[model samples]
Every structure is written in C-alpha cells, then in structure tokens.
Target chain A: MIVAKDVSLTYQDGTQALKDVNLRIKAGEIIYITGPSGSGKTSLLKLILGMEYPTEGHLRVMGQSMVKDEEDNIRKLRRKIGPVFQEFKLIRGRTAFENIVLGMRFLDFTPKEIIENSYMALERVGLKHKRDSLVDKLSWGESQRVAIARAIARKPSLILADEPTGNLDLDNALNIMDILTSLRDENTTVIITTHATHLIEDKEEGTFIRIQEGRLKMERRGVEAYE
Target chain B: MNKRAYNLAYFLKESKTLFKIDFLSNIFSIISIGLILFILSLVLLGWRVSSYVIQIVEREGEINVYYDLSLQEKDINYLMEDIEKIEGVSSTSLVSQDEAYNRMAEILGKEAGILELFDENPFTPFIEVKIHIEEVDSILDELESMLGIDYIRDNKNIIDRLQNILIILKVLGVLALVAIGVSTLIVVSHIIRQGIYNNRDQINTLELLGAPDIFIGFPFILEGVFLTLLGGVIAFILLKLVLGLGYSKFFTALPFLPLPAEESLLIPIGIFILLLSGLLGIIGSLFGLAKDNEKA
Candidate 1:
C-alpha cells in the first residue's frame, strides 16, 4: 500500500521532477503508470524505494514513512517490495538461478524455501531452462526475465518495475508486460512504469495513471480495478 | 534464510570471492602487516627479557662488599662477624679471589676467552651478603658505616639499570604496537574499500533487494580478517624462528642472563598478536563499510 499527499520533488540542481502529486495505491492491485521520457516516472519509483526523498509533502509505503531520517526503517520495509529496474541489476558472472537465489538469501525464507521459490519464480518468468546461463551472457530479454524472477522469488507484497519493457522489440516487450502484470496475483500489488502507451491500450483490467510533466494527467480504472 | 538468521557457508563463499578478487594485492598487504608485527614481537621480547632480569635481581637480594686487602686475615674474619651482626643481614660468606675469577669465567660463558688475556687473576675477594630485599636499604646503610669497607657493590644499582632498560623496552614495545595497529588498520580498510568499489554494483543491487547491512557487509569483514589473520600467522612463525635463534646465541654469549622459558614467552605473545590482528581486521572492515555508506 502507498499513500502520497501533495508530494513534490526538486533535485539538488533545481530540476523539478514531481509537483503536488497525490495518489492512493491499494494492495493486490495492478497499476500501469504511463509517461514520456524524463516525465518523473522513475523518480516516483525511487521515492517509493527510499532511494530519494520528496522535497515537500509526505509519503508512506507499506506503513513506513518515506523520509530522509527513516532510511534504515525504510530499508527494512523494502523487504516486502520487489523492484525491477530498467537495466536488470543482476550480478555479472553468476548464473540466472544464482541471481534469483541471491535476492532471496537475506529474506525471511528457509534454505529449502529459498531454493523452491527461486525455481518457481524462474518457471513463472519462463526462464527455468535458462537458469544455468550467466547473467552477462544472457540476451537482453532473457536478462530482463531473470531480473523479474529475482524480484518475484521472495514473494514480496509489492512489486515495482521501472521500465521493464524498455529498448525491447514488440514481442519481447509484450512478453515482459505479461509476466509483470501477471505477478499481481492475490495479496500482491504491482506498479509498473513505462513509456510504451501503445501497449497499455490493450489491457482490459487494472488501474492506469498517465503522467505528462510532473503532474498526473488522467486516471482510468477498468473492470475489477481497486476502489 | 530466516529474517534474523544468516548462512555461514554463504558468507564464507562470498568472503572467498572478495579475497580472490584482488589476491595479489592482498598478499602484499599481508606481508607488510606481518613484517610490522614481527618488529613489534622483537620489541616485546626485549621487554620480557629486561623484566625477567629485574625480577631475578630482586629475588636474589644479594650484594658484594669489598674489604681492604691490607687487612690481615684475622681482621677480615672480624669484619664478616660484624656484617652478620647487622639486624637486616640474613647471612654472609667470604668469596676468595680465585673463586671470584672462576665465577666470572662461568658467567661469561663463550666470552670467557677474554679473561685469558690476564696472566694473573684480576679479581678481589668480597663478602657476599644475602639480605631480605625489603630490608636492603637498612642493611646497605649499616654496611656503608662499617670499618675497613673499601667499596660496596650494591645489586640495587644493577636492578635500577635493568629497570631502566625495562622501561625503555616497554616504551618501544608500546610504540611498535601502536604503529602496527595503525598501519594494519589503514591497509586493511583501504583494501576493503577497494573491494567495495569493485563490487559496488552488486552491493547496490543487494541493498535494493532489502539485504541487511550485515548480510551485505559480512563478506567484506571476513575478507579483512582473513588477510590480517594470514599476516598474524606469518608473524608468529617468523618470530618463533627468530626467537629460537636469538635465545641460543644469547645463552652462549651471556649464560647468566635471566630469561623466561621460551614457551612461556612465545605462547602468550603469539596468542596476543593473532587476536589483535583479527580484531584490527574487523574494525578496519567496519570502517571501510561505514565510509562507503556515507558516500552512498
């Protein structure tokens, strides 16, 4: 769950990334955030991830305050979050399975659970067969899938994907979207940011928000979308 | 892993990876740390030896008082009885000139060859007094006032000199320990920082994945400890060999020198260095990790 009230973010160089943003996100809902390049999409994700703080206004994610001083607690709260970056931040020289397992190693999972969840996540991302391939050697799409697997392996309640479909062909991008959107199952909230507006036009369910400069331009709720 | 639990095997594997990442550089750090620690060991050995000599001097509580050679044998016997009558004197014995020369030869050991330069015995007879160390001041006071006294050789003077040497050795040992501590800390921390930079991406990824600082930093800590521990072992072995060689030579050159047994001296110092090395490694790694955190 996320709550933002009149949030504004200005960088050190005085670049206004977000302005007076207010939104409420519920658990177990799939959210599609569409925005153009440099439209503050990643900045919002960074705030939720505690990598940045809002210059004004208040924000909370999963009952943890998203402030500068609460960084340590925010980090603990992040354990319940699964984030997929635009660039898959998988460690080089490690196999896809190793990357997935590494992400779950520090979570509250037993050794057996770690192993089982990793294999299951890989299966879900349709990369179970590529589990042995080193991350550096994997193709872009396969690497992205491994990143998604790593994120989902720990069964976090919230999943935030920043441009998962970037720089990919239509087929691969759609495949990634399918995997990420499907990750929003029971008891999981999935928020994805992307510039690929054309792809979201086909989605029949889930909540959608469009960001134009630093402000939200529109909000659309399809069937079965949250209140 | 459970929320508060950690996998030791995983941490060790990560440590191995970190250590292997810059194996050549780590080897150099270990060698430098070892040599520094070896210097400290030598200073510590000097401290121990000087302290032991002082202890032996205090325990023997013995001094030699020379009498006028012009006095007749009857007068020397009366002087001995007078020394015995002193309140603090435990006992006294007359050491003959020949006996004094022979004792010097035995004390010199291999260096006794120097005494052969003399055609005649270059030694004097003296009254050896065994007094309680606590009663030494009163006894020396009494002997200095006695008649026919030529020169009184107080062992307390030697004890004072030995004490000075002990103080000097102690100061040197402390300085050496501080130097080794500071250098090892700097080297280990710098190396750990390099490791962090090399794996910054992975560290960032781990941080984002909600890994606790301990989980992220434990491998680095292990890496530092491994380097210093290796250094400590090297220092211990090299010190052992050097002490072995030095002890044999010292006994040959100055057989009367009081030294603690080799094992008693080495085992404690060996344990101390190894423990200190491990402790320094841990502190250094923590410092490195904390600095990185500040940067982030």
Candidate 2:
C-alpha cells in the first residue's frame, strides 16, 4: 500500500540514491525488490519507512505522506508496518519471547493477545524451543528468526524485510523466505528487498521489481500479468 | 492509556534493568541525594525550633512597672486596677521586694551567694504587666503617662533580638530549600540522561518500532522516581534518628530552650521531604527526556 510519483532522494553530500522513481503498489501484494549492493534497494525501503524524505516529488505509505512535517502521522503509519531489518535489531539481554512481546506492547493489544501472538509467531518461525533463550546468546539464524517473529507478532498490515536472506545457508534462507511469504494474506502486503535473487527466481505470483542505478523496472504475475 | 496499564509490569521491570545497568553509580546517586535531603531536613528543623522559641517568648510579653515608694496599700491597689484596665494589658499583679530578691537568687543559680552582701532586700516591688507583644508601644506610652509610676522596664531589647533571630532563621530556611531543590533537580536529571545514554540502543529500536515517546521514556522516568524516593526514605530515617538523639541531648543540655515535641516537627518535615523528592524526580526526568529528544 505505497504510492510514489517522480520520487528522487539525494543525501546531504549530494549523492543521488534514487531518481524520478514512479510506482504503485496495492494492498496484499507480495513484492520482491531484487538489486545488487548499494543499488537503491535500501534507499527505497528507507523512503517507505519515513526514515528519509524525498528531495523531489511526493511519496505516500499507507495513505500518509512521507514528508518532514508529517513525522507524527508517519509514526502512526509505522505502527502498521512490520519491518525485518537487515541487522535484525534484536535487543540484547532479553529473551526471544520478551523481544517479540515488546513489539506489540505499545500497540492496541491486550496482554493476553500479545503473549499468544508472540508464541504463535515464534512457533511459525520454528523458534518456540528457543523462546526462553536470550537474543544475544542465540545464533545468527536463531536471532534472525526471533526478529522475524517480533515483526509478525504485531499483525502488521505491511511487512518490509530488508536483505532477509543475506549470509544464510540455502536451507535456512529458504525457510526464512517461506515464513515471510506465508504471512501474506488478503489484508497484508509483504515487500522484501534482497540481493540474492536466486531465492525467488521462479515465483508464480506476486510482483518483482528490479532496480539499478537509481531507476526501477517492474514485472507482475498471475491475473495482473494477463491484464 | 489502557495499553500502558497492561504493560505496567514491563515498564517497572525495564526500569529495574535500566537502574542496574550502572548499579554503582545509581547507588552513589541515592546516597548523595539522601545526604542532601538530610541537610535540608536539618535546616528545616532548626528553623522550626527557633520559631517556636520566638513564639513562646513573644507570648510571654511582660513589663515591670515600678511605683512610688511612698504609695500606701490602698493606692497601690487602685494602681493595679488601673493597669489591668488598660486596653492592651492582659493582667497585672504586684511583686513584693522579697519575691524580687528570690527571683534574682533563682536566676543566679549557683552564684546566689553574692546576694548575701546586701543588708536588706534591695529589690523594689513593681507591677508586672503582661500585655500582647504587638501592643507593646501603646502599652508603654499609656504606662509612661500614668501617675505614681516611677519607671517602666520593658523587655523590648530581648524581644527585638529574638525577632531578629527568627527572621534570620526564616531566610536561611528559604535559601536552603531553594538550594536543595536545584541540586536535586540537577542530580536527578543527570542520572536520567546517563541512563538514557546507556540504553540508547533499546530506545532506538523502540523508536523504529513505532512505539510512542512515552512508552520508550517511561522506564527512565520510573528509574528516576524510584531512586529519588529511595533517597527520600533514607533521609527520613536519618532525620528521625538525628532528631531522636538531638532531642535527648538538647533537653539535657539546654532544657530552658522552648523546643517543640519531636513528632510535631518530624511528621511534617518528613512528609514535605517525601513530596518534594517525588515532585523533583518527575520534573527532572521529564527535563532529561525533553533534552534527549531535542538531541535526537
């Protein structure tokens, strides 16, 4: 649920990250943005996350503008986003369950719901056995699963996974991809950016967007492809 | 608000974790805050005791009126009635020469042997007029105009000195209160800032998760309040002990000083310190949070 029109982002040092990008993404659509390193994939994600404002043109995520003055509204918009960061950003000194539950603590969820959803997400990520383990003590793969569980526990309408398959074995990366893809439903859209294009080369559905040198090329599948 | 209520335990636990992040520093902060509050409590106690003494002295306002030595008993009786009827006078009574000599002997205590040098009772009988301190000038003027009154000896100098001491005590009390408030605020705010710095990673993660500022900052605020409250309790206990020990020694050493009962002074000062600690804790934490937010 994002819309961008002629959006261009240039950093303070005048390095242009994106140039005149225009795209429209509908709800409940899974998007795989495939690009090489420093190919504006993360920059696009940053724009969508409201971490940076566009230098030119307008961008909207979940009906809220990505502008400097609309920071409060953007924050509200972020509440509906489940972001799996590249580094997994799991808080140290906390158990996996605690980390997951913390994501939903400030949302509109009862204590019981938060705990239940946390457990359910942990089960989906195959981390239920490690739920009591401290995040810092967990292995890299285990910590990534916990981070995914934390993102999914909030039942966010939009999920953005940045480089989820980075540095993972094929089996673990496939499992992670399966968990992220299965989360998409009639009401939830998942957008994933990855440098590893081999993970989803033969997907029969969803949208595939390719970016290179601050430009975009989109390819759709299923009934949208026929249209 | 309801979500915050549900997560109350989480916030408190987070606060505990934050406090323990720098355990030694936090402990030191509590001790310093406690000692500062103890100093404030002592100043307040001094102010209270001094004010009590001044009040007792003011309420015992008196003037000694010496009459004509040749006045007969009936004339003296008439003069007493006239003095009692004065607008500001509470009561009047005659002190005989023997009673005056006895009073001096009691005042001199162990040095009463010097009075043996006198061949007769050297003291003169006078009318002791008790009047309201506020009406001193008017009462003295009235007495000076009366006939058969040879001299009026008022304890105005002592009363003035007592009032001056009370004024000084009040000024010192106010100064101490302001200084303590500022110092507590600074210490608490610095502690909160340090905690925020230590937990900056968690804070950043929460911020990216769309958590409200209140949710993210609540733990730091709780840590601040808990530390200050603990400090306040420590100060209260120390103050109670000091008061207990000081009261016993003061009554033994300077029993003539008018001191309020221990509870009368301790209860109110204890309550005030606790309240001030709580108030300063919240304000200082908020200030720290605001400044941190500005930096962010």
Candidate 3:
C-alpha cells in the first residue's frame, strides 16, 4: 500500500520535480504511471522507494512513513519490495545467476533452496540457460530478463519497475508484460512507469494515471472500470 | 529471515568475491609490508649480535689486582682469601711473580725478549680477578681500600669505561629498533592506503551490502599481516643462514649473540611482528575507508 497526500519536491537547483499531489494505491493493485520526460514520474517512484524525501507533504509506503525514518524503515520495506531500475543496475562483477540471487542473500534460504528458487526465477524469464553469463556479456533484452528475474526472485509482495521494457523489442516487451500480469494474478502488486504508448492496449482493467507538466491529467475510464 | 545466518553467509561470500576481484592489489600491499618487516628484522638481528659480542668482551676484560711483592707468602694467602670474600668477586686466581713473568714472556715472544734480558723477574705478583661483571660498579669503592698494601695496583677505571661504552651501544641499538619499527609502520600504511584508493568502489559496494566494518576492513589488515609474516619468516631464515655459515668464523669471538636462546626466539619475535603488521594494515585501511565514506 502507498499514500502520498499533497506531496511536492523541489531540487536544490530550483527545478520543480513533483508538484503537490495526492495519490493512493491499495494492496495487490497493478498501476501504471504514465508521463512525459520531466513529468515527475521518476520522482514519484523515488519518493515511493524512500530514496528521496518529499519537500512539502507526507508520503507513506507499505504503512511506513518514507520521509521521517527513511534509513531504518527503507531497508525493512525494501525487503518486501523489489525495485527494478530502468538501467537494470545489475552489478557488473556478478553473473546473471548471482545477480538474480542477491535479493535472496538477506533471506535464510539453504544453498540448495537458493539454487532451486533462483533457477525457477531465471526459468520464468527464459534465461535459465544464461544463468552463469556475466551481466556485461548479456544482450540488452537478456539483461532486462535478468533484472525482472532478480526483482521477483525473493517473492517480494510489491514490485516497482521503472521502464522495465525500455530496451526490448515488441515481442519481448509483450512477454515481459505477460510475466508482470501473471504476478498480478498471484496477488503481487506490480507498479510500472513508462512512456511506451502501446501498454494502453494491454491495460487489463487496472488504474492508469497520466501526468503532464507536474500535474495529473484526468483519469480515463477506457481501460479497466475501477471498483 | 534469520539475520545472523544471513549476515554470516553474506560476509563469507563477499570476502571471497572481494579477494577474487582484487587479488593483485592485495598481493602488492602485502609485499610492501613484507619488505618493511624484513628490514626491521635485519636491524633486530644486528642489534642482538652486537649486544652479545659486547657482553662477552666485558666479561673477559675485568679489573686486575696486583699484590705487594714485600708481603710474606702467608700474608699474601690471607689477602687473596679476603679479596675473594668481596660480593662482586666471582673468582680470583693468585698469580705468583714468576707466573706473571712467564705470561709476559709468552706475550712478548721473540719481539721484546725482555724476560731473558732482565736478571730478576720485573712483573709484580697479581690476582687475576674476573668479577661478576654486572655487580662490578657497586663494589669498586670497597676494593680501592686495598691500594699499595694488600694489592700494589688496580685497573677499575678501564673496566668502568668499558662498561659505559657497552651501555651506550645497548641504548643506541634500542633506539635504532624503535625508529625502524615506526618507519616500517608508516611505509606499510602508506602503501596499503594507496591500494585502497585504487579500489574504493569495491569497498563502497561491500558497505552497501550491509557488511560490518570488520568484514569490509579485514582483507587489507590481513594483507599487512601476511606480508609481515612472510617477511619476518624470510628475515629469520636469512639471519639463521648467515649466522650459521659464520657462526664459527665470526660470531664465536662475539659472545653477545645469545647463540641458541636468541636463535630459537626468532620465530616467536617474528610472529609478534606479523601480528603487529596485520594490526597496522587494518588501521591503514580503516583510515582510508573512513575518509572515502565521508566524501561519499
């Protein structure tokens, strides 16, 4: 769950990253935050991830205030949430398999259990054969799969993906969407931010909040009818 | 998640990865420390040998007390017994006038030929006194009372000067050891800090992964320790090899080098230095890490 009530952020260099905004998302909900460049999309994701604090108002994620006790609660909240970066952010030194299993290091899984779950996650992303391949050696599409596998490997309740399919072809992008939608079916919350207009066709009856110029546009009812 | 087990496994895995990533750097740091340790060990070996030689020479060069030729044989025997009763007189041998002349003749063989030229023995009767060298200073005033009556002569001034020189040499040796140790630490620390500067990103990543400070800092410390141990062992071996080859030729004349005891103590002393080097390495790495972390 997340709640941002009238939150605003301004950079030190006098740029308004996020305007005063009110937003809420319930547990087990898949939401898409769509906006143009500099529309505060990444800022909103960072605020939600507790990577940055709001300048004006409160922001809460998973029932913990993201601003006041960021250091203490960020790690705890992160344990239950998987964040996939736009650039993948996989460690260059680690192989695809090792990258996928990094999240599980904090968990007390046996070595065998770790191997099994990691293999399963890689298999889900169709990257099991490239398990031992280094991240530097991975093609863009293959690295994207590895990032997704890492995000979901620990069975985190919430997954925040920032342009998860940015570098992928249409077919690979659709497969990524299918994988995310499948996670939603299992009651895992998946939130993604992207400018890819084709995602509207596969909206799947969920909320689509669009923003422009640091302000939210009208919520369209064309996709999935909200309860 | 079980935090304890998780942290343990993470530390083990991270340390392993770190070692693999920067094996060459670690080796370089260790070798730098090792060279410093080797130099320090050489100084110690030299000091030990010097002191041992000084001690031997001092023991052999104690004061000689000559007896009055006018004293009767019974009186000279009583005087010898009285001198032996002194606290620092370890042993005193009574040398008759004839024995002194014989000793001088042996020394001045073929050169002076004074013993044959003189009609009577020119040497005075003397007591060959080898005092317990350490206690020689305290009993000097008591022995001076025997001047010109029971003893005709004494060489306390010469013994005093010799002891003073040995003391000065011992102090200089200790000062040299301290200087070498401090300099070794500085040089090793500088090398390790430079290595840390080169691979700072690796350290940052480990910190981000929630590694405890010791886990992050230990490799550099161990690097120092390994180098110190290796250098120390090599130094000990070198010292022994050199000493062994020259034991009979050079060191037999110099009794200051405690032959078996000091030789056996080398390993233990080297181990102590190895531990110290490791500690220095850790400190150096931590200092660099702290500065980098602050900048970050």
Candidate 4:
C-alpha cells in the first residue's frame, strides 16, 4: 500500500517533477498511471520505490515513510515490492533463470522455494524454454519478459512496473499488460506506469490516474480509493 | 546466514567469474604478493638464525691466555691452576706448542699454507679458559691481574659485534613484517576495488533488487581471500625449496654454521604467513566494499 499527502518533488536543477500529489493506493488493488513523455509518471514510481524523496509533504510506501535517512529500512521495504524497470535491468552474463532467482535469493525463501518460484515465474512469463539462455544473448522482447519474471518471482506485496510495454509492438505490449495485471492476488497491489494508454483503455476495473506537467488527477472506474 | 550458505555455489561461481574477468591482472597480483612475502620470509630466517647462533656462542664463552714461552713447564702448570682458581672461571687447560699449531691450522683450513712461510711453528702455548658469559668481565679482570700472562684474547669484541648484527637483523625483520602487511593489504584491496568497479553494473542491479550488501559483496570477499591464500601457499613453497637447497647444498660448505633445523623454522613461519594472508584477505575485501559502497 502507498499513501501520498500533498507530496511534491523538485529536482536540484529547478525541474518540478511532481507537485502536490495526493492519492492513496491500497493493498490488493490494481492501478494505472498514464502520461506523456516527461509527464512525471516515472517520477511518481521513483518516489514510491524510494529512489527519490519528496521535497515537501509526506509519502509512505507499505506504511514506511520514504525518506533518505531511513535508507536501511527503505531497503527492507523494497524487498516487499517488485519493480520491473523500464530498461529491464537484467544482469548480463547470467541466464534468464539466474536473473529470476537473483531477486529471491536474499529473501526469506528456502532453497526449495527459490528454485520453485524461479521455475514458475519463468513459466508464467512464457520463457521457461529460454531459461538457460544468457540475458545478453536474448532479444529485447525476451529480456523484458525476463525482467518481468524476476519481479514477479519474488511474490511481492506491491508490484511497480515502469513502462513495461515500452518499445514493444502492440501484441507484445498487450501480452505484457496481461501478464502484469494477472499478477495481482490476495494482499498484493499492482501499480503500473506507461505512456501507452490504449493498453488499459478497455479495462474498466482499475483506477486511472493521469499526470501532466507535475500534478496528478485521479479517475476511479469502480474501486473506491484515497482518504 | 543460512541464505549465505544457500548461495554458496553461486558465490563461488561469481568469484571465479570475477577472477576470470581480470585473469592476467590477478595472476600478476598473486606473483607480486608471493615475492613480497618471500622477501619478508628471508628476513625472518636471518633473524632466527642469528638469534640461535648468538645464543649458542654465548653459552660457550671462552678466552685464550698467552704467556712468555721462556717460562718452564712447571710455571705454565701453575698459571693454569691459578686461572682455574679464579672466582668466575669454570675450567682451564694449557694448549701445548704442537696442539696450538694444529688448532690454528684447523681454523685456517685451506688458508693454512700462509702459515708455512715460518721456519718453525709460529704458535706458542696458551691457556684456554671457559667461563660463564655473564661473569666474563670479572674473570677477565682476574686473569689480567695474574703474573706471567702476557696477553688475554677474550671474545668480548666479537660477541658485541654479533649482538649488534642481531639487533640490525631484528630491525630489518620488523620492517619487513610491516612492509609485507601494508603492501599485501594495499594490493589485495586495490584489486578488489578494481573488481568492484568492473562489476559495478551487476552490483547496482543486485542492490536495486533488494539484495543486501553482504549478499552482493560476498563473492568479492571470496575472490580476494582465494587469491591471497594462493599467494601464501606459493610463498611457503618457495621458502621451503630455498631452505631445502640451503641445507642440502649451500650450507654444507659452512658446516659449523648454527642455522635452525628446517622443519622447526619452516613449520611455524608457514602457518603464520597463511593465517595472516587469509585474515588480511578478509579485511582488505571489507575495506574495498565499504569504500566503494560509501560512494554509492
């Protein structure tokens, strides 16, 4: 779960990345953040990921305040959240299976759970056959799937995907969106940021928040959210 | 900690990958560290041998007493008896003319031909007195006060010089110890840092993936320890070979030298170097990780 109260973020170079953002995302909900290039969708994700701190106002992820001084606790908080980076961030020189398990090795899982989850995550993303393939040798689409598998394998409470459908063709983007949305389960919250608004336009169950310049406006389809 | 064991195979594989990434550089580092440790071992060997020799020499403190040969045999006997009666003197003996000549020839060995230029035996009868080294001064004073003793050749000057050499060797050993420690630490840590830099992307990925620093840095620690341990083994092997050669071939020429038994010397120093290298390996890796992670 994430809570943001009048949160604002301004970079050192005078770029207002977010301004007076107010929203509440609860556990077990699916949410979408859509905007144009440089529209602060990723910035909000970064804030939720604790990669950046708000210049003013308060923001908490999973009941923990996202502050620079709480770095160690922030790291512990990260363990509960799965993040699929825009660039994939799959480590090179490792197989797809290795990449998936790398995300779970430091968690509380046993050795058996680690292997099982890695196998199931790869199967879920339709990359089980390519598990042994090196990430560097994989195509861009395959790499993106590996990154998604890595994120989902951890079985995190919150899944934050930053432009998971970026650079993919229409079918692949739809596939990624399906795979990401299907990850939501009991006690899990899924938050996705993408500029491809068409992928979620027909989906009417989740809340939609639109951001422009530096402010966010939320439109709930059926779910009730925020204080 | 259980997680660490769970990832033990991965840690080893990652360390191997890191070493292979900079294979030639690591080999050079091992060789350089080995040579540094070898030099330190030599200084230690010199210190040990000198200390042992000085101890043995001190235990057998002796001085030569020369008197006028014109005295009758009975008077020489009296001189010997009087020397034995001195407070600190343990025992005394008179060296006859022929025995004194033979002793000189034995000492000179190959150089004894130089003494043949004399028409007859150039050596004269003298008293060989052995005393406790701590009582050397008192015994020498008593011998000097006795009559008909023309000269006393106490080994005080030689013993003092040997002690000075021992002190110098000890200083050199301590310096070598410090130098080996500092240089090995610097090289190992620098290499670990370099490996960290090379694998920064992997580290960053792991960090962002919620992996702990211990999880991320454990492979690097293993890599450093492995390399330095290898270096320690190499240093020990080279030292053993050198000492083996010393005892079997080189040192045979000077059989009277008081070098320590090879096993006694090698076993302890070998254990020390291996343990120190392993310990430094762990510390250096930690330093490298702390320094780089601080920047991040």
Candidate 3 CAPRI-style tier? acceptable
Best by DockQ: 1
Indicate the worst ten consecutive residues by lDDT in candidate 1 chain A: A218-227
Tens-place lDDT per residue, model 3, A1-227, is 88888888887788888887888787777878788878988888878877678889888888888774566556567667777778777777779998777656655566666778899999999998999999899999898889889878878788888888787888998898778767877778888888886865566466677877676653534333544
Candidate 3 C-alpha lDDT tens digits along B1-296: 45555546665565455545557765654565556656666555555555555565565646677666677788767877887888888777887778887776665545456567788777777777777767776656677776445543444565556556657666765775576566656655555466466557555433333334565566555554444555555555665565566765665545434454545546655666666565654555456556544665
List model 4 lDDT by residue over B246-292, tens digit each.
Answer: 99987766765666789988998888888978987898888888888
**Which candidate gets the maximum lDDT versus the true structure?**
2
lDDT tens readout by residue for model 4, A1-227? 78999999999999999999998887888899999999999999999988899999999998899989988888888899899999998988999999998899899899899999999999988999999999999988889999999998899999999999899999988999999888764567899998998999999678899999989988877544342
Record all residue pairs in model 1 with backbone atoms less than 3 Å apart, i.e. clashing: none
Q: Candidate 2 — which pairs collide?
A: none
Interface RMSD for candidates 1 onward, in order:
2.9, 2.6, 5.5, 2.5
**Tens-digit lDDT track for model 1 on A13-63?**
999999999988888888889888999999999999998999999999988
Any residue pairs clashing in model 4, and if so which?
Answer: none
Taking chain A of model 3 alone, its TM-score versus the true chain A equals 0.93
Q: What's the C-alpha lDDT at position A60 in model 4?
A: 92
Off by over 4 Å in 1: B1-6, B69-77, B110-122
Worst ten in a row by lDDT for model 1 chain B? B1-10
Q: What is the per-residue lDDT of model 1 for residues B141-169, given as tens digits with 9 covering 90 to 100?
A: 99899889999988887887888888888
Per-residue CA lDDT of model 2 for B1-296, tens digit only, reads 36667689899999999898989999999999899999999888888887887788888889999999999999999999999888889999889999999988876766689899999888999989999989999988888899998998998888788778878888988998899889988998999999999889889888888998999988889998998888899999999999999888656555556678899999999999999888888988999899898988
Rank the models by DockQ, top first: 1, 2, 4, 3
TM-score of candidate 2 against the unseen true structure: 0.93
